[model samples]
Target chain A: MTATATNKQVILKDYVSGFPKESDFDFTTTTVELKVPEGSNSVLVKNLYLSCDPYMRTRMGKPKPSTALAQAYALGQPIYGYGVSRVIESGHPDYKKGDLLWGIVGWEEYSVITPTPDVHFKIQHTHVPLSYYTGLLGMPGMTAYAGFYEICSPKEGETVYVSAASGAVGQLVGQFAKMMGCYVVGSAGSKEKVDLLKTKFGFDDAFNYKEEPDLSAALKRCFPKGVDIYFENVGGKMLDAVLLNMNVHGRIAVCGMISQYNLENQEGVHNLSNIIYKRIRIQGFAVFDFYDKYSKFLEFVLPQIKEGKIKYVEDVADGLEKGPEALVGLFHGKNVGKQVVVIARE
Target chain B: MTATATNKQVILKDYVSGFPKESDFDFTTTTVELKVPEGSNSVLVKNLYLSCDPYMRTRMGKPKPSTALAQAYALGQPIYGYGVSRVIESGHPDYKKGDLLWGIVGWEEYSVITPTPDVHFKIQHTHVPLSYYTGLLGMPGMTAYAGFYEICSPKEGETVYVSAASGAVGQLVGQFAKMMGCYVVGSAGSKEKVDLLKTKFGFDDAFNYKEEPDLSAALKRCFPKGVDIYFENVGGKMLDAVLLNMNVHGRIAVCGMISQYNLENQEGVHNLSNIIYKRIRIQGFAVFDFYDKYSKFLEFVLPQIKEGKIKYVEDVADGLEKGPEALVGLFHGKNVGKQVVVIARE
Candidate 1:
């Protein structure tokens, strides 16, 4: 006879439309064997923390061809996302009991996963907060690393403008630009986030996008010399404005368009003709494409974290029951920084 | 003593709005000395053939910061464009009397221009039709070479799509992709142009965009594997449609936006989010940036022309008096190929 334990999970009620609310998710409890099945490569894990990301919103929409990158969440099932978990039992050769790892796992108290390359990254440095694995050490961290260094091809003294600059990925991009000796400005939805960008993220300048009447005018005021690189996060009107302000031979690394994910119809961008006039290059990328460099990313970032040269902030929700509200709050800009749902501390 | 000649010219009436018409341009006759000024570096030339291109539309607009690349055409002055000319007098060291060249010159019978490195190129291969310089060997040819080869980065067996397929630049782009062993498709405004693309230009398939109700569906039908490269000549709705049908890691080279250049307000492009999902790279370039590679371009194309492997077509307007109607006809899709105003044969 094998040992068994109760598993609590946050389940999706149905395919979501428009802005997702807490009502779109439900809770369920089930019993599972604490041990991995005989002769299986699966590892049974106890979920510690779950990441609340803007990309998760794309997964909530009804199944469609465009959202093929991230598959639609299955109805009446535990929604899966990047999470930090501890292996309770394992039949996989790479993982043993008590091994820490972060990757895609269900929104639950316990999960059974088959470890695969990129699907799961084994944690080596436990000296830092394990919760950081859900964000600054996980997918969002790699996104900032690859999107900024690889895609943006940043150079010293160049002007970098990041929209959604106080969020998980944006905050880190701003810091990285600062580290590279770039002149960085960020835009956030709230005054508090704007302050955090300047004070915490070390941005040269920060603006509350919600307070600005005209985005183009705001950009013109901030970047009088014109923008050399744009880290595009919030699309729609912001992208249109940034296009007008981009310098000749400028580059735009498109990571996310959070502003348009919830809308039934995405907004139309009018100033794309500037792409021609300014001889701009716009490239889109997904973090998964750069996961192979996770080890190199950790090498670059972990040192800064330990030296206190880099700072990170988390708006964490306690317990699995709070996961629904935490994830939904991301769309409303209710979370101040990297939003995480804490399931269990150890 | 210098000889004088009657210089018949076409002058812009004023900054244009909406669609430009023949009435927007007025005729002027001025007597000019057929010689470069003493102690001046300028070269005097008799304009033989003036090339009518879509980009000239931007110059006709009211002077603004955005149109800084090509300065607005001076109001009530003879408009300038790429033209084939015979030098009658030269004070510059590089050019001499009786030399043929292709570069920017006024839409007049005679022009005195100070030729710069990129502004003028001395013609060497005159075995082909001299008119070819106005279209195939001139600025439009260089635009196609740089935009397709450097920007698109095409690989063999990729599916390529070109808009405005029978025009000067687009025609060359389609043929270049075919030469690279790629499957090429093109879209034009009329059946005649479509037939020319499939038969004359060797495109795998061709479509008349004006007849297609759903542009995306039409693309899906033409490219069952999705478009790997998009030569963006006409912007607005076509760009939005191309975004939906782009393959993963596809590339788009934005050469021109003839469809939107005449509009007071450019049409907003939706579906830009596809850039992220598809990991697409959209790059805009000006041929002026690639002028240094003109010799390599000539080396590549001259042999093809000599071997009868290249073909070029021109819709020649008879005289300087017909320049206004010929240039304006491009907006109405009335010209079948490269439009040229022939002021003189020799």
Candidate 2:
């Protein structure tokens, strides 16, 4: 057996301008020793799955002080994101060889990581699908939990509206709202996603936003009373329309603005006066902020998953070469569900 | 005195579009009984000081289900707003002849009101100028109180920004933030108002927004560490700039959008994605929502006034004839401070 292996990586060509193209990412090959450095508390892992998220688009943009949560991806370097991996070697006290984990990892076959608590998690439940770590049981799960329950401050029998409904976070947010006994409605870009929301995810109502000329009228139709909680996944015109349709004292938990991420200049939201008129609360949040609540989230959602009370779907793209297209497809709403790029089966 | 007295009134000529003008208001005189009808459970009040507030502009717009916290002013009818008045006659158990109160009253010489608790506050501390009830002790006061302390959730040593800083609510917000030990910066339309913000309102820094070509650059210059709490009065471009300059987990208390109220199509606020990037919370609120906290607010600010620790400034427009210009001048940023139209001194 060789001590080193060839590692393939996806590297950003340059900082993106408008919408990112698949060609913006280039593949590179390098050889690396499959061992952690002596006396270093880092862990070496083999990448299994890489999660494609809307926030990734933000990271692709030109680096600025005001750029959201994640720092901009460096040119000619392998982009890192939430991924499932198996430890090849461990110098970290908490992890051991063959231990599965999920966290910010390079989009390469093998990479060394300084395992920080919360940022990286040693997967305990191998009972569930290990690839679920890239999505349902990982960052997106925590995001939906914190944003819907905490930020939204939801109540039973209230109405909820989720945009990007069939995506990793939105799908879970809809289910969580329903479990809380709230009437949940969702908007997705495709008819297939809309169907998934209504049929598979248990959303009370779902709409293909592309089919609706007037988003405000669509929201009014879906929520005859008014939207009490808006899980904002898409920004721009959708946000403007939602502002007009929101109920008095409505809460908008902004998890992501997928639509605005790719635009050079973000669309101007005009119905902001409705914010004051409705006494609405629009809160923007990141998953990193609520990492502490992860254990409690796992406790709540694990049972639901085991009992079939909860469901998760993923659009898996096989192999490292397909990573760029899988990610770039997210902005186009080409993925029907959670987009995950699989590098290895085991 | 005659049983019937001629009552002079400022009437809304029609529903206003674009910038409101003095011509939008028409004055008329009609006979009033000067006494409440027997068993009517109402009080007849002789108007003294009428408040000219920016939110009143929303009331003049064509009525819609989403017309903010106020109803539209009916054409050819007397407009109603916060005013201080002396009770000429009373059938309500809560009020008596010669009692002074402040509430929603007709913009007329004498008005009959069915006094509701909290909506109408009887003068308890008459030593302070009675006209103050139209501003410092009234609705705008409560607005500043609720928005800054409760919504902003300010911490000591936080950075606070106030827009339209020389106006009624903005002045109070700056002062309150200063009292909370926050570093306060404010933006006003003119040089004189900017000086008033720093000197009279005790704002740490002040800028004339009209002179600055780039609002965001001005904010960055003032808030080097970024704004922790923003008391949003003027919306549109100012709000967009504030969003860019907000610190992580910043709170924006949206009180009024005077800039957008007069426009046929409201300006689009493009920086909303910052809500998530910075984890910002933008809350829209009304004074009506916080009336329950009135006594608590009074207890907090009344002592400050009595000790001369707090100072209030008002640009007084004398006589009922000047009420039209006084109210309309608010949109033009012509009023130096809290704009008040005095109908009678006693």
C-alpha lDDT score of every prediction, in listed order: 0.93, 0.92
Residue A59, candidate 1: C-alpha displacement in angstroms: 0.9
Q: Is the docking of candidate 2 incorrect, acceptable, medium or high quality?
A: medium
Candidates' DockQ values? 0.76, 0.80
Could you tell me the lDDT of residue A108 within candidate 2?
A: 98
lDDT of 1 by residue, A45-67 (tens): 99999999998888888888865
Provide TM-scores for the models: 0.99, 0.99
Task: Show pairs that collide, candidate 1.
Answer: none
List of clashing residue pairs for candidate 2: none
Runs off by more than 4 Å, candidate 1: none
So what's the TM-score on candidate 1?
0.99
